[model samples]
Target: MKDEKFNILLADDDPDDRMFFQDALDELSIQATLSEVTNGSDLMKFLENNLNKLPDVLFLDLNMPSKSGMECLSEIKKHEKLSQIPVLIYSTSANPEVVEILYNMGALYYIRKEGDFSCLKAVIGKALFLCRNTRLIQPERPDFLILVDDIRPKLPL
Candidate 1:
């Protein structure tokens, strides 16, 4: 089946990371129109300026300068105009505390930046597929970041 094209946005401070992310998207099966910003402030500005052009998903890095991802997430959730955009925390840190914080804050997913390009391709593809089908709905802790092959549902007996 032919897949639909999706608009995706990434906000990260690292130049290399942005380039790598774009390259990863290039390898995906689905067509994605990706745009980027370098910091939390730019992300917000872009969203505000393009109120009617919000992306299908937003990949937000947590450690950006000017403003942190947490700050951006808070701002986005508080604003009625921007709250529906699905936010995925894209950061290097996989600290339990940080993950819990973001998960509780309504982030749909959290991905620790993998160094391998193949892994990046797989993760991004999976994220896109999942978001496209589910509207990037927030998953519970156990199922949030697990691949489809690896998830074991905790079904009630």
Candidate 2:
């Protein structure tokens, strides 16, 4: 079978962060097709429009206009077809409550966006690598890949 190009849905209000992520992905040599949304509403619209091409991974920003990241996470997880696709919360805020709430709500990972462009590259590289490998589990990665508990909260529909 042909190796499918990984589709990544990146939702962020900041234009700079969006562009930066795209550039960083290229620099990291992670093969992916990225789709972007500025807010939760846009994200929902995008998903509704492209149901056939749902993203393999979702990179979400917590604070966004129209709707919030946490709200979006809740909605995405509630969907039947979309729930299986891993959703990673990538935000600037490292708020413990936000992290806990997202984790509790079934987010695959909660990543705090930080550092220079190089740092972003490293995080993205690791995320993609871990995501591509399912059988091989390891410690000290990001929150999303490290959680192996299958009995966790199922997306509420």
Query: Who wins the TM-score comparison?
Result: 1
TM-score of each: 0.90, 0.83
lDDT score at residue 114, model 1, on the 0-100 scale: 76
Tens digits of per-residue lDDT, candidate 1, 1-157, equal 1267788999999999999999988876678899999999999999999999898889999999999999999999999989999998888888888888888888899887878776666677777767888745687787665342342132111
Weakest ten-residue segment in model 1 by summed lDDT: 148-157
lDDT scores in order: 0.83, 0.74
Give the Cα-based TM-score of candidate 2 against the true structure.
Answer: 0.83
lDDT at 139 for candidate 2? 30
Off by more than 4 A, model 1? 146-157
